[model samples]
Target: MIEFLNPAELPRARAAGALVAGILRTLRGRCAVGTNLRDVDRWAQAMITEAGAQSCYVDYEPSFGRGPFGHYICTSVNDAVLHGRPYDYTLADGDLLTLDLAVAKGGVVADSAVSFIVGGSNPPESVAMISATERALSAGIAAAGPGARIGDISHAIGSVLRDAGYPINTEFGGHGVGSTMHQDPHVPNTGRPGRGYTLRPGLLLALEPWVMADTATLVTDADGWTLRSATGCRTAHSEHTIAITDGGAEILTLPPA
Candidate 1:
């Protein structure tokens, strides 16, 4: 379902978005070499509960995933990319970790993801991949505004990734989000401009740009939720929830200082 938040509802959406962003920031700060994945999940759970927010993933059971994800946050390290279920693995220096989070507050839901390297180890390839996704995400957001089409956003995002020499995957991408975690208007990472749904005020969209280093193919881990690169190459993902307004797109998810 596609949801458009009226002016009055936008504030609630922003609040949820802020909470999601803050949780991710907190988690990222706490993550380091020797930190357990379960520890990250627990931190997320604590913050969400303290904020009186609901997790969109904890009890999530979709056809593509195992029932009841049973995790507060998605902790994907190195090869793992999307839907990464928290496990017993401890983070290592230079490990590329992606934290994806979603939360519902005041009846509105917001989703966002961030990819960063754990500890002080900076692998050039890993850093490049993560930077590429963030740049692609920024490009997509720049193209979002009233009268714009979803394809425009997708094209902008795809161009960035392609130019960076990364393969694109369309099976899972951004979508309309508000009140619920995922909604209609699937925003592929790549698409032709001047196509798809036209942007309008009050429309909320989650613009995510993710890519694999070598191939576009993905393999599901034994856990049935974590999606990893088919070639086992490092990956990166960046996302944010934005609200379309008369002026342009307003980014709702930003980490607090």
Candidate 2:
């Protein structure tokens, strides 16, 4: 379902967005080479509980995933990309990590994801992949606003990823978010411009741009949640929840200045 937030509910949306952003920021800071994926999930739970907010993922039961994800955050490392459930693995130097989070507060929901490298070792390929996704996410956000078609955002994102020489995957992409997570208007990573749903005020979209280093194919881990590259190539993902506004797209999931 496609859900839009009225002006009265905008504040709640912002609050939820801020909470999600803050938690992600904190978790990112705590991650290190020796950090355990399960520890990361524990930190997320603590932060979400302290904020008096709900974790949209903990009890999430989407058809594509195993019922009740039972995790507070998604900790994707190295080859893993999307829907990475927390596990017993400990991060290693130069490991590319992606943290995707969603939280609900005041009856509104916000989602965001970030990719970064653990330790001081920054592999050139990993760095470039992460940068590409971030740039694609920015491009997608820049293309969004009132009257803009969803395709415009998709095209803008795809252009950046393609230019960076990464394969795009449309199997799972961005989507609308409001009272609940994962709403309508599937925003693919790549598409033609001037097509698809038109943007309007009050609309909230989680625009994510993810890419695999070598191929577009994905393989689900035995856990039935973690999506990894078919070739075991490193991957990266970047995302943010944006609100369509009168001026332009307002990024809701940004850490406070």
Candidate 3:
């Protein structure tokens, strides 16, 4: 379902967005070498509960995933990319970790993701992958505005990834988000401009640009939720929830100081 927030509802949406961003930043700061994946999940759950917010992922049972995800946050390391279920793995230096989070507060939902290296390890390839996704995400946000077509955003995102020598995957991409976590208007990472759904004020979209280093194919882990690169190549993902407004697109999810 596609949802457009009324002016009054936009404030609630922004609040939800801020909560999600702050939680992500806090969790990211706590992550380091030897930190257990379950620890991250625990931190997220506690923070959500303290904020009186609801997790959009925990107990989530989408058709494509195993029932009841049972995790507060997605902790994807190295080869893992999307829908990564927290496990017993301890982070190591130079591990590329992606944290994707969504939460509901005040009847509104916001979703966002960030990719970064753990333990101060600065692998060149990992940095490149993360930077590429960030660049693509920025491009997509820049292309979004009232009256702009979804294809324009997708095209802008795809151009960055393609120019960086990464393959594109369309099976999973960004989408409309509001009171519900995932909604209509699937925004592919790559597409032709001037096509697809037209943007309008009050529309909220989660624009994510993700890529695997070598291939566009994906493989599901034994856990039935974690999506990894088919070639075991390192991957990165960047996302932000944006609202179309009278002036332009307003990014709702940004890490707080």
Candidate 4:
């Protein structure tokens, strides 16, 4: 279902976005070499509860994932990309980690994700991959605004990833996010410009650009939640929740500095 947030509801959306962004920033700061994945999840849960917000992930029973994800945040490590459930694993040096989070406040939802290197031994390849996704996400945000087509955002994001020499996966990408975590108007990473749904004011979207280092194929982990690279190549993901307004797109999930 595609949802359009009225002007009054936009404020609530911004609050939800801010809460999730703050939660993600705290989790990112705590993630270091030897940090347990479960610890990150616990931190997220505590923060969400403290903020009086509802987790969009825990108890989320999606068709593609195992019922009731039962986690407050997604802890994707190294090759893992999406739906990465927290487990008993310590982050190692040079390990690339991705954290995707969504939360609802005042009945409005916002979603975002970030990727970073775990320790000082940052692998050049991993850093490069992370940079590519961040660049692509920026481009996608730049192209999103009222009267723009969804394909324009997709093309902007895809161009950066393709030029950076990473394969694009269309199976899972950005989508409409408001009042719920995932919604209609599936936004792929690559598409023809001037195609797809026209953007309108009061619409909320979560634009995410993610890519694998080597291949486009993905393999699900035994837990039936984490999606890893088919060849175990490192991956990175970047995202932001934005609201379409009269002037342009306003990013709602940037963390407090």
Candidate 5:
């Protein structure tokens, strides 16, 4: 279902967004070549508890997934992209890592994701892929505003990724989010503008633009959660939750300094 935030709940939404952002920033900083993905999940659990917040993932059980996602954060590495369930794996140098997080505070929820390289040995291809997702995310955000159509935002995002010569995967993209991590008004990576749901003020959207380095096809891992590129190529994802306002969209998730 598509859920919009009330004026009274805006502040709480902002707070939840901030917490999600801060957690992502902290996890990114602490992630290293030798860091274990499971340990990172543990750290996220501790931080969420300390902040008096709730994890949107840990007990989440959806038909798309094999079972409940028993983790606090999604730790996707290299070819993995969406729903990357954390496991016992150590990061390696030059590994493209993606961290997706969502949390609720004061009954409001915010979701966001980021992709980065492990260690200092950043491969040129990996760097370019990460940059493309970021650019697409920015383009999608720029296209969002009151009265705008959801297709407009999707078109903006797809234009960037496709123009970059990367295949677009529409299986998973952005979505409406407010009190829950995932909501209605599904936003695909590519689409025609002037179509889909009409944007309205007070609507909160998580605009994520993600892509695989080569093929658009995806293969599920043995864990039945992590989505890896079909060709085993690298992947990257970028996301943010924004609230529609009077003039334009306001980004809710900004990491604290």
Candidate 6:
């Protein structure tokens, strides 16, 4: 289902976005070598409760997943990319970590993700992969606005990842997000411009651009939730929830300035 927030409801969307962003920022600061993935999930739960926000993932039971996601946050490390279920693993130096979070506050929801290196060890390949996703995200956001086609955003994102020498995967990509965590108007990472749904004011979209180091293929972990690169190569993902507006799109998931 495609959902749109009226002007009066935009503030609530902003609130949800801010809460998600703040939680991610806090988690990123606390993450380091030897930190357990379960600990990350616990931290997210506490912060969400303290902020009076509901986790959009805790009860998420989409068909693609094994069952209800019983975690507060997605902790993807190194090869793991999307739907990374928190498990018993301690982070290591130079491990690329991706935190994807979504929460609801005041009846509105926002989703966002960020990938970064865990500790003092910053591998060049991992750093470059993360940078590519971030740049692709920015390009996708820049292409979104009133009158813009969803394909425009996809094309903009795909161009960057392709130029970075990374293969694009359309199996899972960005999507409409509003009252719920996921919605209609599926936004692929790559597509032709001037196609797909036309942008309109009040529409909320979660634009994410993710890529594996070598392959576009993904393999599901034994846990049935974590998605990893088929080649075991490192991966990176970046995302933001933006609200389409009269002149342009407003990014609601940016951290506090």
Per-model TM-score versus the true fold: 0.99, 0.99, 0.99, 0.98, 0.98, 0.99
| Runs in model 1 lying further than 4 Å from the true structure | none
For candidate 5, lDDT tens digit of each residue in 1-257?
A: 88877778789988999999998999999999899999999999999999999999988998989999989999999989999998989999988899999998998889999999999997899899899999999999999998999999999999999999999989898999877888989999999999999999889999999999889999999998999999999999999999998879999997886
Clashes of each: 0, 0, 0, 0, 0, 0
Lowest-sum lDDT 10-residue window in model 4:
118-127
The segments of candidate 5 whose C-alpha lies over 4 angstroms from its true place after superposition are: none
In TM-score terms, candidate 5 sits at 0.98
**lDDT tens readout by residue for model 1, 1-257:** 88888898888988999999998988888998999999999999999999999999999998999788999899999899999999999999999999999999999889999999999989999999999999999999999999999999999999999999999999999999878888988999999999999999999999999999999999999999999999999999999999999999999998886
Which is superior by lDDT, 4 or 6?
A: 6
- TM-score: model 6 vs. ground truth: 0.99
Extract clashing residue pairs from model 2.
none
lDDT of candidate 4 over 38-67, digit per residue (tens): 999999989999998999999999899877
Whole-structure CA lDDT of model 6: 0.95
Worst lDDT run of 10 residues, candidate 6, spans 118-127
Model 3 CA deviation exceeding 4 Å by range: none
Clashing pairs in 6: none
lDDT value, residue 48 of candidate 3: 96
lDDT string, candidate 2, 1-257, tens digits: 88877888888889999999888888899999899999999999999999999999988998999778999999998899999999999899999999999999998889999999999998999999999999999999999999999999999999999999998999999999988999999999999999999999999999999999999999999999999999999999999999999899999999877
**What's the lDDT for residue 68 in model 1?**
89
- Candidate 6 per-residue lDDT, tens place, 60-120, comes to 9999999999999999989999999999999998989999999999988899999999889
